[model samples]
Target: MDIPLPTIAVVGLGTMGTGIAEVLARAGREVIGIDISDAAARRAARALEASTARAVGRGRISAAERRAVLARFRTFSDLRAAADAGLVIEVVPESYETKLGVLRALDGIVAPSAVLATGTNALSVTRLAAESARPERVLGLHFFHPAPVMRLVEVVSSVLTSDRAVAAVTALARELGKEPVAVGDRPGFVADGLLFGYLNQAAAMYECGYASREDIDAAMRLGCGLPMGPLALLDLIGVDTARTVLDAMHAASHDRLHAPSPVLRQLVDAGLTGRKAGRGFYTYEAPGSAVPVPDALTPSPAAGAVPGRQVASVGVVGSGTMASGIAEVFAVAGYGVVLTARSPEKAAAARERIAASLARSVDRGRISAGARDATLARIVPAGSADALAEVDLAVEAVAEDLEVKRRLFATLDKVCRPGAVLATTTSSLPVVACARATSRPADVVGMHFFNPAPAMKLVEVVRTVLTCDEAHATVREVAATVRKHPVDCGDRAGFIVNALLFPYLNNAVKMVGEHYATPDDIDAAMKLGGGYPMGPFELLDVVGLDVSLAIERALHREFRDPGLAPAPLLEHLVAAGCLGRKTGRGFREYGRR
Candidate 1:
């Protein structure tokens, strides 16, 4: 039997409320849209009609369908009109007192069984439920912005909420074509819990001068494939709104990470709220405009003090995937690449891998067929370190074992020219360790590249204490030559990306272990709410649980921070042989398991 759609009432018809009302009405529900004043109600009605007309223009709905959808909506400035609604979703401003007052009013007017839901992104649902006489009928129906477009909805249930109330809301969300995930009543719930921490960290990164806003955003976008960089997304979300969300999460969790960065508060105080205010991290032509223009706050890239040395040729070590990819990156940039492996067969295999990767790039229109063939031609297969004797730079992409890297560096230091730059592509291990192995520590540096080096655009140019200015400048130039954004940082365990990224992933695991949220729900929250390309669990599965555990442990050991410690669940999964994609099992199951 088909479940009948409920008569929905959306109160406080602002942007979010109006969108919810539109979504409910389009889903064939009789929607009562309410506001505090006649002008507010009229504005909401006009917004809804304009949005529906846009749908008609886009062929998303016919003119007849638009009219039919509009017919389902009834606007009112009085609360009594919604007394008969089966479900009431309050989209009032995110003020606890204001929401509580509205809930109390609804409690007096609505039917005894009517479900009262709040469209809160932050704020305690449990606390909100306390304001209602019928707490069992109160739940949270937290929707992302532009409710009609975003597919995810967090259905939060307080301890006092009845299961039937939660189920009804979940079913209603499904009826509206949304992916609803059940969550326990917690401040920020699942999405903002995982999201705001990352955003705050990004803000801290900018404030501390770790990297420019553009570079930080570019790194995530081009490296991790996120929909938008943190700063740009912050601007779109409104700096003031972000500050409010962060403050709420901090008050609830007492986690220092959720505290809004001082810069964020300052920007909000300056009335640079975001796109809605025409200025934030970036400037806009007018309030509510999407187009961003360069602002006075734009950060300038650090100018390298030493001049970069010329490099006509580069040599890469190892036969691994990273090695092949690195060789391809250098080759595609028109550098003569000498790729070496332990044996002739291994070197031949690496060449084939590089050729295949370039061919795929051509197939995807990333490069032309001519460029692919030309890139492959520049990569020469070699079986010995002696092949790097004349190269200007040699980067080793061998296994993570320190001794292995140490031994390789020693050999390269002897074979390569006196001034040739030596780099190690270690993501977690210390760059200084590799430098110590080389006779000329001044010439050695770390050039950490993300996986699939040919595709990723960010390169961490690490400078050790012993590294000279010239060596750092040369590597930075080489990174730019290969079309990668170079961010300078000291030689540290996990560096920037791994240090920041692993802890966030581990927190998601901890949240699952604590049963605060399910893996699927957490993943959906991060992806849909946070605009991440992959949820933490999904990323862990791809990166392998064992690898994530290893990185987290390294970070913990280096920082001596409990928060960086590997989650017990991660260790248990790895110990159980559930090492993610490799073992076909981790946070989630894969393959034929």
Candidate 2:
């Protein structure tokens, strides 16, 4: 049976509360918005009006519709006025005492069957429910900040919350046009538990100078296709709220990963609570603004570059998926591409795979049939590394092992011309040792492309001290030619992307390991709570568990830091062959049962 949309009362008209109220009223439900004081209530009303006016100004809503929403919404000076409401959601400040008072007050006034929901991010929903007179009706309806826009809503059921209460709230969330995921009441619930833990780790990375803010962000945005980088997200979420949420999750879970990064606390204490305070991981233009001006404190770009190589042809070695993708990228960029494999048949198969991939792109309108044919025309398959001798540049997209990479570099050095630039597509191994295998060490640099190389944007150009200016310059030019953003860095393991991204993902794994929250909850937190494109665990599965563990191993080995060590959960998952989306299992299962 369909229940009519309940008249909703939003207690505590702060940013989140006001937005939620506006959303309800805009949906044609009568909304009673309350704050502690008249001034705050008036401010919330004005804010709601301004937001709706902007929608009208932008031509998204007509003037009459805007007026209807404003008229339907009410600002309450007294709690008793909310008695007529059928559902009351508390969006007060995240203080336990403040929330308790509102819930207790509402219990005294509203009908026993009226649903009670809290829009809490971190505090235990069960504990808050216990404080209410009608515990069975009290539950957590965790809304993402800026409640009018973000799509996700966590429908949390406390130990005492009734199934009917949960159903009503779920329906309400859907009525408000948001996706709802149900979870048991717990600290950080679904979103903050996973989001803050990762954000804290990113802050810790920034404090340790693992990578620059721009590169750290670029890694996730371009490398993983995330909507925003961790540091920048921390700034947007406000370091103060992030620090508090971290502290709360740590208190509840006692997981090291959930512990607030010392830098987060320091920044908040110093009055740099991200965009709200004009500074945090990066400085912002003003409070609540997303544009952050780079500060002097942020790291300068890596020094030095390699000179350009004058090769008209390029050789790409390997028969694996990445190898085929790399060959395709070079071919599409108009380079005469020579692809190599162990046997003639294997090389031919790799060429066929590249053709198939380009065919899909053509079908998707990303490329033209003529362009695909042109790219295929530029490719030639070789049976051995000896075929790379005539090419001006050779990029090895071989297996991610030191021994195999060393052997490949040793062979390339012997086969390729003296001045031909040598490059590795290794995301984790140090480029220096690979370069050292060749007599002209300066000729080797890393040209790392993300998975599905033809589609992803970032390419980390890692240059060792031994790498000559000409070699670095050549890779950068190649990156540009392939329509990739090339960011230069020194020859360190993990380079820029994995160096910063993996640790954050690894930290989330640890948080789940310690039972901070469920895998579903953790993933939701980052996607909803932090506005990331995908949750940390979701990314881990997509990147492959084994691949992430290898990168974590490289980073831990290079820094010798216990913090970078791969979580036991990751080791267990890898050992079980739950390698991620490829294997149909990881932090979360993928594909049909």
Which model scores highest in lDDT?
A: 1
TM-score of 2: 0.85
Off by over 4 Å in 2: 1-5, 37-39, 51-65, 104-114, 131-134, 294-312, 359-374, 430-433, 439-442, 463-470, 489-496, 499-593
lDDT by residue (tens digit), candidate 2, 1-593: 43345588999887788888888998889999887688889988899889988999999999999988889988877889889888898988778998888899988999877888888878888888887788998889888877888878889887798888888888888888888888776677656655666677667766776666777777768887778888888888778888778888888767676788788878888998888788878887887787878678755545763347786899999999999999998898899999999998989999999999989999999999999999999999989999998999999998888889998999999999988999999888888989888888988989998888878899998888898778888888888888998877777877777776787788778768877566776676667656677788888888889999999999999988676789999999999999999998888778954
Residue 358, model 2, lDDT: 89
What are the Cα lDDT values of the candidates?
0.87, 0.84
Model 2 has an lDDT value of 0.84
RMSD list, candidates in order: 2.7, 3.9
Cα lDDT tens digits, model 1, 229-283, are 8888899888988898999988876777777999999998899998999988878
